[model samples]
Target: MKKYVMAGAISSILSYQACVLAQENQSKSDFSKQSYFLDGFSRNNLDQEKVALSTHASRLVVQLATDYQQGMAIDWADYLFSEKLDGIRAIWTGDRLITRQGTPISAPSWFTDDLPDYAVEGELWAGRNRFEHVMSVVMDDKPDDMEWGSIRYMLFDLPNQPHDFVTRFDALVRFVDQTAAEHIQYVAHFPALSESHVQSLLTKVDQNGGEGLMLRKMTGGYDLGRSDNVLKLKLAIDAEALVIGHVEGKGKHEGRMGSIVVKTDDGKVFKIGTGFTDKQRGTPPEIGSLVTYRYNGYTKNGIPKFARYVRIDKSKQ
Candidate 1:
C-alpha cells in the first residue's frame, strides 16, 4: 500500500495535527474523510504540476481578484475573461493537493495519481451553482469515491511558471493532456470584444446560473494579493464575514433566526436577514463561522446594502 507522509503541520489543535499526520486514515489504513478546504478561456488557452508533499502547504499564496468597475479605463482587449468558478481554491504542490488554508483533501488515489509533478492552481468543481453540494462532499473527513468521481479539477493558472498569463495557460493545456486525467480540465478564456460585449457576456453568464466573469490581463504575470490586473464582475458581489450573533425572527419568521449579525474583516458589523431557507433559518450559522454573503454596493453608513447569506466555507461547517 502507498502511504502519504503528512508532516510539519502548524495547527495548534492536537487533533488537527493528528489528522494531518494520519493522511485521512480512519480504517483499514485507507483514506476515509478529507477536509478540504476555475476559469474560462478564449484569448489564448483554457490551458493551464506536481511535486513532493510539502508541510509548507499552509504557506501557499494565490493571486486574488479585485472588484471590476463598471466603466474602468483599462484596455479590455488586454484581458481574457472566463467564468468565476464557485469552487474551493486548491493548490497542487507536486506530490499532494492542499486547500487554501493548507489542509490535505482526502481524495482517492485514482483521483490524484495522474496529476503532474509540479504546482497547479485551480478549483475542485462539481458543477455550476453547486457550491453547497461541493462543500459537503469535499469537506468530509471520510472520502466518498462516488461523489469525488463527479468532481473535476478545473485548472486556471500556473503559479510558478515564469511565463506570462497567455504562455502559462498554453503550457497548462499541454500539461493536462500529458496526464490524460478525465477529472482534470482547463477553463477557456475569451477576448474582450467591447464594453457592451463584456456586459452582454456577464449577463449571459448570470442568466445561465453562473456567478460571474473574471478578467485577467493577458500580459500580467501571476502576482499575489488583490490587483486590478485580475478583476471580478458579478451581478451581486459576494464577500466573506465572520458570524457574530443571531437575531430572533418576528412576524411570519417568529421563533427561528431572524437574521445573523456578521462582522466583516474591516470591523464593520451588520445583520443579514434574507437568503436563508427554512432549514437554514432553523440552524443559522454558528457564532465565529466565517460565512459568505452577497450584496450590492455599500450604503452611506458603509454597510453592505441588501446583504444576504450565502454558504459557509466547509472548514467552518
Candidate 2:
C-alpha cells in the first residue's frame, strides 16, 4: 500500500503533562513494576546505539491563526502541510516496528505483508475516529486477526535517506504515488500561497477532528532532540506522565508545595503543580498508570518548574 505524509507540528505538552500525574505519589521503587512499552521488543537490529537525529526533525509544531493577515511570516514553506491524524506513532526500522513509547505492535503478517525493508515513520491507525480502540489493539501485541483487518500503516518519512524534512517529504509523496496501493493513501499536504490559505486549512482540519498541523523547514538538517523550528499548536487538553521527584511548596501549601517530577517517553523529566485541584492531590495517580498535569517553562537545571495534577489518563498505556 502506498502512504503519503501530512505535515504539521506535534506538541509534547499534553504527553508530558500526562506523565506528571502518572508519577504522582509514586516512588522510585515502583519503576520496575511498570511495563514500559520499550521492554517488549526484540533487541536484535534495534539500533541500540542512539544516533544524533537531524538538526530539524519532523517534530515541528505549526502555529495557526484565526484570520489570515497577508505579508505576515513564512518558515520555509518547502515543508508539506497535512491534517495531523490522531493515531499511534510507529517507527519501522527494517526488522521490527514499534510505537513512540516502544511497544511492539502485533500486526498480522498480512497487515505488513507489503512493507519493504526500509526505516519508515508513520501512524498505526485503524479507522477514522477509532483512535482509542485502534491503540488498544496495536499496543496490546495480542495478534488479533480480526482487529488487524481494519488497520492501515500510514507511512510518511523514510529514515535512511538522511535528507532534510522537505527532501524526505518530497520523496515520500512520490513513492506513494508510484505504488498506488488502496490500503495506503498519501497524507495530503496543502500548499498555502497566502496566510488566508493556511487559516482555511486549519479551520477545516480542526472541524474535521484532527489534532492540528506541523510546520517543517525544507532545508534544515534533522536534529536528535527537540528543535524550536518544529512547533505544535492545539486546543487545551490534559495528559499524563511518570512522576520522578518533588519540589518545595510555597504559600499555604508551601511546606508541601514544591513541584512534582515527571518523565516523557523520550526520558526528559519535568515538574507539574499548577493545574491540579485540591481533590486531585488527595488521590493522586498510581506510580505506573498514566496521569494528567499542566504547566509551562523549564528550569535552568533542565527540569519542569511549575506543574499541577489534572486527572488520570484512562487510555491504554
Candidate 3:
C-alpha cells in the first residue's frame, strides 16, 4: 500500500508539471501570433506609452480582496479588520504613485517628496463617501493641485517585505510618523474577534456613511492578486450586470425614465428602478452598457433580491 501511494503521488506531480509546461508553451505561441493592435493602438505601443508616462510605476500592483460570505472558512482570531475606504487604489513605487492598471497618476512632485523609498500599497482617499471627488482628482490627465490637497494616501501594506502583516503595519505607522507627511498615513485596523463584533463594526461604519470593512489575515504575506488572505465584508453586496433594455416609466417617473432591464453575470434577468437620482433618470445607463446594482441577498429563484441601481460601470467603457 505504501509503495502504491508513493507511485501515485509521483505520477500526479509529473502530470501537473506536464500540464504547466503545455500551458506555458501555448501562451507563448498565442502571444507571438496575437495582433499588436487593440482598440486602435498597437498593444506594444500602448505599453511603451504607459511606461514612458510613468516613472518606476510599471512593476507595482496592488493586492485585491474577495468578498466575505457567512460561515466562510477563515480563522477570525488571525484576522484584523479595517474600514474599507472607497477610494482609488494606488501603489506608491517609492518615487511616484500609479493606479493598479499601471496608469501613472499626475500628482505633483510635492505630494510624494516626503514619502519613504519603499514600495507601499494603499488607497488614495479623499474622505468618507467622497469616492466621486477622489476619482475626479486622480483620474485626470493633469491632477488639480487644489483637489489633490484633499487627497490622502492611506497606506495598508508594504509589498515584497519579509515581515508579517502586524510587523509591517507597525513599521508603516512609525515611518509615517517620522516623515510627518500629512497626506501619507496608515489605515487603522483592529482585531476581528467574533461574528457579532464584525456585524457591530459594519453597522457603525455604514451608519457613519463609510463604505464597508476589510479583513486581513495577520500571518499572511502580501499577495498580488485576489487572495484568501484578505476579505471584503459588506452589508449589501453590489455586482455588475449588462443593461439589455429599459422598462418605461410610470406615475411619478413618467416623462422621465423607468426601471432598467439588466442581465446578471449568471444570465438572470431583472429590472432595477429604485436608488436612482432625478438626474440619473434623465440620463439613464444606456442600453447595452454595464451597470452596478446593490442587493441584500439572492431570492429562492437565484435572482438578486431588493436590487436597486447603484451606478454605471464606467470601467466597462
Query: Using TM-score as the measure, which candidate wins?
Result: 1
List candidate 1 stretches off by more than 4 Å. Answer: 1-57
Which ranking of candidates, highest lDDT first? Answer: 1, 3, 2
Ranking of all candidate structures by their TM-score, best first: 1, 3, 2
What are the candidates' C-alpha RMSDs?
13.9, 14.5, 16.7
Best by lDDT: 1
Q: Is candidate 2 or candidate 3 better by lDDT?
A: 3
Clashes of each: 22, 49, 1
Residues 223-242 of candidate 2 have per-residue lDDT tens digits of 44455434444433334587
The CA-based lDDT of model 1 is what? 0.72
**What lDDT does each candidate get?**
0.72, 0.50, 0.69
Q: For candidate 1, lDDT tens digit of each residue in 235-292? A: 8989899999999999989989999999999999999999999999999999989999
How much is the lDDT of residue 167 in candidate 2? 56
Q: Each prediction's TM-score against the native?
A: 0.80, 0.55, 0.75
State, as a TM-score between 0 and 1, how close model 1 is to the true structure: 0.80
Error of 2 at 302 (Å): 17
Residue 238, model 3: lDDT of 80
